[model samples]
Target: MSKIKVGVIGCGSIAKHRHLPEYANNNNVEIIAVCDIVKERVSEIAKEYQAIAYTDYEELLANPEVDAVSVCTPNYLHAPISIAALQAGKHVLCEKPMATSIKDAEQMIEAAKESNKKLMIAHNQRFVPSHQKARQLIEKGEVGKIYSFRTAFGHGGPEGWSADGVNSWFFKKEQAYIGALGDLGVHKTDLLRFILGEEFTDVGAFVETSSKENADVDDTAVCVLKTESGIIGTLAASWSYVSKEDNSTIIYGENAILRLEDDPVNSLVVQYKNGEVVKYELGGIQTNDAGGQTNTQVIDQFVSALIENTEPVVNGEEGYKSLKVVLAALQSSETRQITSL
Candidate 1:
């Protein structure tokens, strides 16, 4: 099969760190074009991969040789760029949280349907080995019916990753829309849905900008979710965590309690009612890049879905569902009451 010609729409940290290298490694993909509002970054990445570069995404999308594009821009740009790419006859792999709102996400999905191009969201956590195992256990009834759960994804701040530190677009409400709830919180929201095979029906939340100085967005958020099946859970996401830990989901079932830790090594543990504990050692699920390119697996799956003519695990609608949960949390936080999904 001929390699799929791919273009990268944003030359930010995520594209530089995850998608670029992963596309280079995938034998079925060719990095043909790259675009960024900053010409220098696009040029640098394009040169590194021996591809063409553009300062505007429209120019890149107009290139007939580009078969697909990765939308790695900020939250606000996701919908517009993705819809444009779909209309341009290119498959789109959009970064997570899908979009800033359900309306925009729905528009992107409609565009993908109208264009008949594959639209996948970059929710890489669903591809983790531990997460995959946990999902299988849940599906097979190894844990029986789930009762309650908790999940969290926290970090110091985006200053370490953003180009402009505290002045980054991430801290700006206009660009990022929401803060930790959209950034780290969406991942857990998607993961919980994926693991439990249930959708959140209602949410109650508390959001605040506690640690980061002069930021307009929330730095920490805590939320309570009620699933459609009546399972209750809490989600906590923060950019103010002095020490980083992406600990997640403790699902209490009748037979066992399943715990998932998002660390690179020790990721899962299951405790039985009979005082027996089973541990799963996930030895570095990262792929081939700095910090092992943790998101590569999902990108690879997107490419494969196109090549093999199959549906992506995290398709546009699935992404929208996850975004709804986060959106509900945001509303609940603002209103100080439960919001129904």
Candidate 2:
């Protein structure tokens, strides 16, 4: 195949803002079709990209022209749509949180294995330049003996990002399953694991819906996590920050502290115990702003993995593990006790 013919399932905000534009920029990809339950959304996106439109995703998967698919649907539809696409002999690039539950995530992974097709999770934070650099630094032991950290991802809410605005499925429990925790928390879970090179073994959480009227899902979550290596940290996800998004991490170690995405000018900063301070001017994290150059290398990475027949950095199993941490947090909150992963 000279170029990968791609079908995008769900022409929602993510497709319109991230996946579609990135695929268009990749010369190795040719978008063959678009599917969405919303006819207007699918039609407009398909016309703009010169691809076939379908309201049903199964119809799009049945198109033999499509060699791969980007599943940008709601959390509830992720596993089923991805499994069907894989079964239809197409590679899948699924959005984060993998599925609403581990059972569904495992099922999707099993389907991918049965089909012998690539299955990558779109954990875009893992593709961020600063995050990549941070991982490199941590692996090199720049901060000796990691002790604790605090990471958070917060914004006004999904209303600003969802195509449906206030009425987006993000606030509905049936479609979203969980709110800020699933939407933003899982990203942090994946990122912290990537950065620290550790797996969380236990979690204690306080999840609540402090804001967003009529939202049945949690709008805020604060979790205390312990890693396998005994490192402790706090993970917070919130939709209450109305003014600006806070996507920052502070890693405290025996030697120094590393700050990530905390400053506007410098994406990374390190403070040594010897009183030496270093700042790195990496790029800014991508936001809802439309005109800036996108930093999410997810599309490019997914295409490369497909072409090279290699595993993506954030594959199905990786997504499943990160989601386990998020789910553990929810369980801990409900039971009022620490949950073991």
Give the alpha-carbon lDDT of every model: 0.87, 0.92
The C-alpha RMSD of each candidate to the native structure, in angstroms, is 1.9, 1.0
Per-residue error for 323 in candidate 1, Å, reads 0.4
Give lDDT tens digits, candidate 1, residues 1-341: 89999999888877888888888888999999999898787888889999998998999999999999999998999999999999999999999879998899999999989998999999987887788888999899989988999888887878777656677888888999989888889988999999999898999999999998868989999999999989998999998877655556688898898878744556788899899988899744443223555554877898899998888889999999999988888888888899998
Q: Write the per-residue lDDT of candidate 2 for residues 85-139, one digit (tens) a residue.
A: 9999999999987899999999999999999999999998887778888888888
Q: How high is the lDDT of residue 113 in model 2?
A: 96
- The number of residue pairs in model 1 that clash at the backbone is 0
Instruction: List TM-scores for all candidates, in order.
Output: 0.96, 0.98
Screening candidate 2 with a backbone cut-off below 3 angstroms (N, C-alpha, C), the clashing residue pairs are: none
Mark the 10 consecutive residues where model 2 has the least summed lDDT: 286-295
